[model samples]
Target: MKLSPTYRMPLKRRREGKTNYKKRLALLKSGKPRLVVRKSLRYIRAQIVEFDPKGDKTIVGVLSKELKKYGWNYSFKNLPAAYLTGLLVGKKALERGIKEAVLDIGLHRATKGAKVFVVAKGAIDAGLKVPLGEGILPSEERIRGEHIANYLEKFKNIKEDFEKIKQKILGEMNG
Candidate 1:
């Protein structure tokens, strides 16, 4: 008897559980700390979580919305924005005495050159170690500066896209 296409795959493979559970288990076993990233259309967030499996505990958290006061308005959706978010989270973590952590990329595939990697780079730049590759080393102002630099570099390609976003933000600010 032949099984259906979906059934041919194991339960874990059929669902997204395999990768997610693997990441969670790895984070739990590493015993170091977990830097988890979650993103959305308007904002991005990162947190340092300690898995207790029996209690409520969150080491630290940083939200992009909160960084807007520092001039990080969400008018851009590029590597630079991601970099800024990472920088903020890393800086906050460092202030809380978190120097090292394990990246828990839940439900997300680990791609070499991706936005998540770029965020990790920003965190590394801010002095957080992730034991995966060479870390990024950045100063406190690195995020804002790098965001500007990246925007300038890709001005030609992203000008049109960012212009619309900028206009919308400006309108909101004015109204």
Candidate 2:
């Protein structure tokens, strides 16, 4: 260990590259539940969480892997799966009486039409009042997996799969 008075000790998570204290502070100050969205190489996950002095409490959570239960046959890490996972999380949050939330994208870059925003879009459509910019979110058609479906046209079997899944997601959101 480098023992020097000039050396400042960083927090454990900060050293581990897991937590961003600055961003977390800002989200906590919003006084709204946070819609935490995360994605891996193979799956996406979304959670509606509340801040607690002791620890963050998850109110509702959904994973793209859960899409299999709804008959999703595509990769769980795709854009459509991210949207559906967000929709599922939003529906559950609403059922728990959570009407609004601020998005917590963590260390992810905020790119235009990123998967995080797609999840936010799904949550918005599910009736959660999360603030979003028109320019950042993907188009309505894209959220319905049109972009994906178009790209998979040659593979007839899976070409329409996402559209069907989007319909099922919408149906679940409605009833």
Candidate 3:
């Protein structure tokens, strides 16, 4: 007779592949609040969360949909929208007295210049102290949607709105 392998029921999330315990452990060990960025095919969301024994508490949350109020009329999953969403989150975090945070892209692969870093760049621009390597962020032109200028005949029109929304976010952050 053979014994079955031991199972740790408490970590059901890890066992079922819902959470990555190792990565979560590392982030928690840092003892800094996590700027968790999660993206769906249609939207992106970021939250500043503090680890707690009872349960992680979210200090601030920002969603791409909020851009609609800032005069953004474009795809929420695009680069510009991602940046704006991050900026929104960062500004809120700063308002709530959160000066710094560690990026937590849970279960997401680290691809250079991906949406994750784009969000980080936005947060940094909003004056949040999120530590990130300069090399990891997408180019400023891309973040500003200028890279598509070459092929998009509609770029001129959409680019104007992009600048407008970016400025709106900055103005809001300052005011």
Candidate 4:
């Protein structure tokens, strides 16, 4: 008998059951806070949540979209933007007294060379330890390449002197 194609396909359901289960178990086991990351096509957000089964509480949360008003252009879908988001979130968490956290990546698989990893690196650079080394990618090469190759094609002749701006961003990433 032939089976339907949908039968073999993985349904879009709460795959987080396993990851969340492991996260809660780890949180309970280690008694450490959770640093959760959620990403989208346009933006990425992070939160440091303290799991208290007995109470309705989210310890602290940082959304990158809020950083736009501070002049963070999130339209650039590259390592630099991802890193900045991570840095902003990490700094906010640190300001709220979150020194360390277990990186709970939710349902997303932790790939080695991926945008999410870039964000993790940014967060790490901003001082949140995630069992990873200093997370700053050489912004000069990556950002410059992305701007000239990806961004320039769509928005021609932007007024923001690309080279100088790239150098400045690279400096910020490095520093």
TM-scores of all predicted structures = 0.64, 0.89, 0.91, 0.64
| Rank list by lDDT | 3, 2, 1, 4
> In model 3, where do residues sit more than 4 Å from their true spots?
1-10
Model 2: residue 172 alpha-carbon error in angstroms: 3.8
lDDT of residue 63 for candidate 1: 67
Each candidate: RMSD: 8.9, 2.6, 2.1, 7.5
Deviation from native of the Cα of residue 161 in model 3, angstroms: 1.8
Q: For model 4, how does the per-residue alpha-carbon lDDT over 1-175 read when each residue is reduced to its tens digit?
A: 7666645533334343444555457655766776777777776777777767794256766565664554545354555566666676677677777888776677777665456666666667677776554342344445334654555665433223334443443455456
* Candidate number of the best TM-score: 3
Q: Per-residue lDDT for 129 in model 2?
A: 92
Question: Which pairs in model 3 have colliding backbones?
Answer: none
- For model 2, how many clashes? 0
* lDDT head-to-head 2 vs 3, winner: 3
Backbone clashes in model 3? 0
- Note the residue pairs that clash in candidate 2: none
TM-score of 4: 0.64
How do the residues 47-123 of candidate 3 rate in per-residue lDDT, one tens digit apiece? 99999999999999988999999888778988888898989898899999999999999888999889988998899
lDDT score at residue 48, model 4, on the 0-100 scale: 73
What TM-score does prediction 3 earn?
Answer: 0.91
